[model samples]
Target: MAKQYDVLIRLLMLGDSGVGKTSMLCKFTEEGFNSTHIPTIGIDFKMKTLMVDDKKIRIQIWDTAGQERYDTITKQYFRRAQGIMLVYDITSEISFRHISKWLDMIDEGAGSVARILVANKSDASALRIISKEEGQTFAREKNLAFVEGSAFSGDNLDEAFEGLVKIVMDRNKKDIDEQLQSIKLYGSRENSTIDAEVKPGGCCS
Candidate 1:
């Protein structure tokens, strides 16, 4: 078979328990959401291969179990992640309040990793304890990419995932470009040294 993608990216969704992390995963990957609330027992994996700006990308999403007991395992996934979505329920004040702690976790595991601040369950506008303005303010304060999403309504899911992917891809491209440029410069320097080493007799150096 022909090559399917230019890159395979690992992304993780993290937050406190009952922030609807799994629901959002199902919403984005399966285009469906589960009404019944089931706490994730362990890490779950999903993959979607698609074209982004003419580049085929296979995004491997790691859905973390949000309970405190599973946090040890969840933190392990952070190290290898290219991007992370820090999610929280709009209706839950406590969930919103814990964003700083989650960010600290991200720093400890994936330092300076690409991240998005997601105010999830936006469909719960009526019950929203954390206002959209509040979320935006916090995102600005943290200088983080931000999106308000609703897994139930399939709202802003694309924007959130795509935004994070774009950030990661851009960073990857930049890093590769720098490395290639460095190699090119090194090759030029090596050739210059070789030319200099060739004396009148062109003897081996």
Candidate 2:
């Protein structure tokens, strides 16, 4: 069978319970939203294929349960992730406050993985406790990409994934380039004939 995509990127979503991690993912991948709050029991994933820079990129987004009990299971996914979405509900101050703790966890396990701070439920303007400026300030401080949107209205929802994929792809390119440069340097040094004494038993024979 032919390969479906040129690149496979794995993304993980994390936040306190009720922060709309699953909803945000559903809106982005399925273009559907459900208002009823059903807590994810553990970790679940959804797949979406997008054409990024003319490359078929398949994104596997892993949605993790936000409850503390599931932290162990969720942390296990961090090392495998290419990007992580640290989601928080704009309407819930407690959830927003917990973003730092989530960041700490990402630092501990994900180790420089591309990350985006997502302020969800922007449609709930009446109940919004976290302002867009606040989210932007925090993101800037942490050098993280930020997006404020609502899964219900699908506003700016795609930006979260698009931005993350860009970061991941850029990092991947840099790594590949560095590897090639190192190989080129090694080849140049190896081919240099300076101070060489011919051993007749080897390739010189």
Candidate 3:
């Protein structure tokens, strides 16, 4: 049997309410964005396949409702997530300030998974409350990638997603390489049976 080349990466989008999480997901997955305020009641999900670094990656993106009551329900989706996007509204200082709590939730629920911080609504420079430099500094302090994007104008939205995919791929490659090295080291021993257990699901599903 030939080895399969399917790679699934689960990504979760989290942040305060009205930070454009749904818009960003729609823009990335379908290249469309709606201006209406149809808040996500529980969780909305979308999937897209892309070629990243010559590998076919199936990205399962989960957009969770930002309401306080949905925190418990949202946390359940974090365990298997390979990457997370901690987004904030660039025009709203309150939303931008709440990133710490969101990060904490990600850490507590997602086991400190790989994440990127994004400042949305970048198209409105005049109403911007969080500057690019500030967001970049904050992201660097937390060792997370940062980008200012706009789902409305489609600025840097694709880059933000592609960047996350690259991160996931790199980490997955490193883990596989480590396992292969361990196998090589142990398999060289005499009369040793390599009992490898393959998991049913990939990173996403």
The residue-level lDDT of candidate 2 at 36 comes to 79
TM-scores for every predicted model: 0.84, 0.84, 0.82
Task: Please tell me which model should have the higher TM-score, number 2 or number 3.
Answer: 2
Candidate 1, superposed: residue stretches over 4 Å from native: 175-205
RMSD in order of candidates: 14.7, 14.7, 8.0
**Model 2: how far is 5 from its true place, Å?**
0.4
lDDT of 1 by residue, 1-205 (tens): 3555555678988888788887888778778777877677657766777678886677888777777788788787788789999999999999898999889889998999999999998898889899899999999999998999898898999999989999898878976456446645553121121123212211010
Looking at model 3, residue 139 earns an lDDT score of 90
lDDT score, candidate 2: 0.80
| Candidate 2 backbone collisions, by pair | none
The residue pairs in collision within model 3 are none
lDDT of each: 0.79, 0.80, 0.79
What is the Å distance of residue 84 in model 1 from its true position?
A: 0.4
**Worst window of 10 by summed lDDT in candidate 1:** 196-205
Give model 3's clash tally.
Answer: 0
